[model samples]
Target chain A: MIIGGGSVGLMISYYLLKKGVKSIVIERKYPGSGNTYKCATGIRASFTSKEHIALMKRSIELWSELRDELGVFYERSGYLWLLSREEDLRTFKTYVSFQNELGIPTKIIDLSEVKCLAPTIVIKDLLAAVYDPLAGKASPFDLILQSWRLLVEKGCKVLAGVEAKKILLSKKGILGVETSAGFIESSTVVLATAYDTVKLLEPLNISVPIEPVPKHAFITEAYRDLFKPLIIDWTTSSYIVQTPHGNFLVGSEIPERPSDKLLNRLEFLRKASKVWTKYFPWMKEAYLLRYWTGYYDMTPDHHPIIGPLDDLEGLYIAAGFSGHGFMMSPSVGEVIADWIAEGRPRVPEALNLSMSRFKKGKLIKEIAVFG
Target chain B: MDSEKVIVCRCEDVLLSDVLRAIERGYRDLESIKRLLRVGMGSCQGRHCLPIIARVLAKTTGLRIDELNYPSSRPPLMPIQLKYFVSDGNEG
Candidate 1:
């Protein structure tokens, strides 16, 4: 059984069903109504964390095949990280070499070469930059929006509008879950509820080390294609990407503020526009259309805590993706499915994301999250 | 007609296929693609080749002109104050 109907939940269900383990997914709201839909929809394998690099690599492989399988256009675009600070330059430089060592082929480019590569960008203040050509962006409208239907078609039972109250753990091996409607008996439970994971796992004494960070994003009206590629602009700390509908979607990292409130603040847009214009001066001509807020399932370290929680039998977690769950869900699903079927992860190295990492002080550091 | 061999990322001396293969290898996001292929990390900051890359991605993905990912943006990776260069003869 799986709790939460977001990207991670549905993806886990998908891989489980593929392995013949029919899963029942419970969602408090309709699928894609949460942060999964509000995500910036950037998928990439350029990461500093060794575990994420492996998982993202495998996840991206699945994403590539999923394009044809899902009948959706998971298109490829380059993610160019412009560096201005020596700190960022050094971080990216180390990441490039490390990524290359892992077959990622990331590299740092020079100033003259930067001009030749992306002339659309105004490079008057660039100090250095890192280039990863194998990154991409897909529309949540195209992928996550259709998750419920696709999941149903794939033989996973999705119980929408139903909330999992708590895990009904008894002597009977995680007896099942108590839901709003009634208790359903299941052998195992997988929590993919994002920030709500804390509440769901509270009964088991598992204090989910995650916080909900409110983030804001806005999109402009559909305009002619003026830009291509998802750019992480450090000066603005915003991720700028144009949606499939022609809207220029922009967002920035905000401090972690866990709350039930998800209101778009004018302050967010006001600052975000500064970054938008800083990168794309042409956006001034475009009109702002819509804006929304979502939460990032943040951990002490940016890396997510996947795998089973300590001392919890038949209970697993795939939460705390730190706002990057959508990009990594496919691989997370593959790994979890493998673990369930084989009593071990398909790749043992993935155990690095285990929740025990915090206790073991084995935290994996990641650098190429936004820039 | 040497478009294939023409430089896409001058920093890495990447060709067109180098950029396209970045996508094929599961680095579909623009940031990873650009960084991996060095398509837009050169001196011009993607000014010369980004449009070409965008056009190709749009065509390859069946996305309309508007459907492509927004072009990458970054602070100028250049134009550091000449004063910084004039700093106490440290290394240079």
Candidate 2:
């Protein structure tokens, strides 16, 4: 049984179907229409940690093959970050070492190279950049719907608009989950509901160290040559990427505050305008097309908690992706599926993502989370 | 804050009638109710609807409004355009 019908749950259901395991996906609302719909679908593996880079590498592979395998729209326009400060460049060098050691193919390029890649972008304060030519974007709606279609075709059950109330457990180990519709008898339960997992499991004294933090993003009206690749100003924590339809998708990180308010801060737009103008003075005249807000399911250390918990048997969690869950959902789905079938995650480092990490004080740190 | 207004979720344009229907169907928690009717899951990030819906829910369920556990309000307290939907690959 899978709780939460977002991309992670749906992808797990699809993989479970492939493994000959029929699972029921319980979504509180229209499945895949929750936080997954609010995600900025960036598929990048240029992380500053070993495990993240490895996991995201696998996710990127799945993303590239989705065009033919799942028949969805995915583009590999690459992600470029402009590093301006000396200390930031130094930290980025270490990231290069870690990412390179993990086989992510991330390269540190100079200002001239950055200019050639995105000539419209101003690199006046550039120290260097970390470029992942493989990083790109996709449509969250398309990925979720296509995965749902595949799940339906495979005879897996998707019960949307149905909320799971609790996980009914027995002393012996596994029992079933109590959902809004009724009770589902299943030995295995995967919580892919992100921060919601905390509230659902809190009644049972199971503490999931995940919190919802507010984030914002807004785009400008379609402009010709708004930049081909995703250009990020690392100093200001702002980024701009042209969509497949020629519009400029822009956003920046606000300090993570423990609030669920989904209001777009006007200051975000104002600061974004200043930052964007500083980088690309030519875009100073660009008018806003639309603006939206969402939240990130942030963990203590920015690493997600995957695998089954020791406190409860047969209860698996694949949540706390921070804000980067969408890009890793494809790979995370397979990881959860493998764990359910084979009794372990496909990636060995996944052990660090378990709930025990918090207790053991073995937090896995990612240097480039908001990046 | 308008007691006479019947809005439940201004972000999605949900109404008090729809929320009343959801609570009538045995939905108790604010999280479940939000999922069912998107009450506080809108643009104002529940600043406008949170207290109102919680008050109505408290009256219906006999639980204190503060006693109810609700999901966090998401960001962008305002509405945005759909043109940006085509690509959000780097929202991280």
Residues A1-371 of candidate 2: C-alpha lDDT, one tens digit per residue: 99988888988887788789989898887765567866766788888777787788888888877778887779887888889999998888888788788777778999898988888777777889989888888877677767766776677888866898888888877788887888889988999998889998898888889888887787665566655668788888888887665667778876657765776676677777667767777565565645667778889899889889897888899999988888988888888899999998788777778999999999887777763
Chain A TM-scores for all candidates read 0.94, 0.95
Each candidate's TM vs. the true structure? Answer: 0.77, 0.79
lDDT of 2 by residue, B3-52 (tens): 33676667667778777776776556676566455455444556778777
Q: Fnat of each prediction?
A: 0.00, 0.07
Question: Candidate 1 residues B1-92, lDDT tens each?
Answer: 46577766664467777766655543333433553454654445666777777776766666665544444353324312222222345722
RMSD of each: 13.4, 9.4
Question: Each candidate's lDDT (Cα)?
Answer: 0.72, 0.77
Which candidate leads the pack in lDDT? Answer: 2
Each candidate's interface RMSD, rounded to one decimal? 15.4, 9.3
How is the predicted docking of candidate 1 categorized under the CAPRI scheme? Answer: incorrect
DockQ of each: 0.02, 0.06
Error (Å) of candidate 1 at residue B78 is 38
